[model samples]
Target: MDDDLHPDGAQDGREPRSGGANLLVFLALLPLDALVGGHAWLVVGMNGWAAAHNGEEATVPVTELVVSGGVPAAAGLALCWGRYWGAAVAQFALTAVLMAWLLSFQG
Candidate 1:
């Protein structure tokens, strides 16, 4: 094809993506976001491990949960588009342990 004129595979731009590919990627990533958000919810809103395993009542106020957990996750999610997306991924990965560790200091 005339598309690959360059040996380096540069044909003025990237190849076109399929709509299904994009949708599939979004579907794949949805659980990751939900996992991060759920961890935040469990930590802040539901008062950590007890809520997850024992059905303990949520002791935290909604506003506090939003401020403490939601903001950091949002910041991490915002980094998804840039080179710093790794940091965002790390933030998501660390959300549960980090929050649990921090909140332990208060209790």
Candidate 2:
């Protein structure tokens, strides 16, 4: 077996470090999701209404709803399934940017 695959020297046969790291990423993002407030729900509602109306006169594309809701979800999933560190970094960066943007209005 490759040594690099088991950086923590797992001779006792245990799951890789990435799994725990991914779980941590998932856990960390949960609060960020909450901090996002009701925007996700609002996006869903808008998309649903627009779909029912055949998107006629819709101000935003349905894809916007998916993106608005998917970013955090995808980040979590990515951490679990793909690059754990990358996902964590991306999630933290996004959260910081969002929080900064929200706080910017407080003068």
Candidate 3:
């Protein structure tokens, strides 16, 4: 006669999980992150294109995009299987960072 709404805590039961759920969450986010990361990485490609086309260096924006996109995603992947709160916070921060990066690209 269990009464807990989840029976497994809020998400990861606040204890050691079997890693499946975290893996699933990671898989779910992988595509989205890859899409965004790929777009961000394209800044490098754009730099090459622009450099070849206009003979100018575009260093700062490319580096900024790579750092902003890659680091948080790597952090998110690293923390996805830690704890419930860890996962939640990582996901939230990841989303926020992604959104902020996306917004930054808007003209």
Candidate 4:
């Protein structure tokens, strides 16, 4: 056993390196963060379009923004952290909010 690599006397077969773990965590979060950030931008763009079309009024994109941004963001975060349950919950909440928005808008 490499004593230098196992300064803390960890019994694992492979020794741990702080740098390697940090790199792995960063790589894992990279994809998730990108996806969520991209979706956030999309939500913003869509809101802009809707607002512009609605005679420049300060319309809140509660539905579009929340569902589109929140679902993907939550899912991405959950995936990065290996939390399937959180992802599922986020999906359900987003769906419900979207449905409510749709029904309310159907006036």
- Number of the top TM-score candidate: 3
Q: Once superposed on the true structure, which residue ranges of model 3 sit more than 4 Å away at CA?
A: 1-12, 58-63, 70-107
Clash numbers, per candidate: 0, 0, 0, 0
What local distance difference test score does each model get?
Answer: 0.55, 0.56, 0.59, 0.52
TM-scores for all candidates? 0.36, 0.36, 0.49, 0.40
Pairs that collide in candidate 3 are none
- Candidate 4's residue-wise lDDT over 1-107, tens digit each? 66555568765454333554545554655565456546655565666678778877544456655665565455545544543444444444544554455334323
Tell me the tens digit of each residue's lDDT in model 3 across 4-107: 43765554345644457666665676676667667665765576678768876544364556565665566575665465344545565766776565545433
Estimate the overall C-alpha local distance difference test score of candidate 2: 0.56
lDDT per residue, candidate 1, 2-77, as tens digits? 7656877667544544555544544555566566556655656446555657875535444554455665577566
Q: After superposition, how far is residue 12 of candidate 2 from its true place, in Å?
A: 18
The sequence of per-residue lDDT tens digits that candidate 2 reaches over residues 1-107 is 77545567655544334656666766777776764535744554565577668955334333544455466656656664555765566666665565444333323
Instruction: Kindly provide the TM-score of model 4 when superposed on the true structure, using C-alpha atoms.
Output: 0.40
In order of TM-score, best first, we have 3, 4, 2, 1
Measured by TM-score, how close is model 1 to the native structure? 0.36
After the best TM-score superposition of candidate 2, give how far the Cα of residue 68 lies from its true spot, in angstroms.
1.1
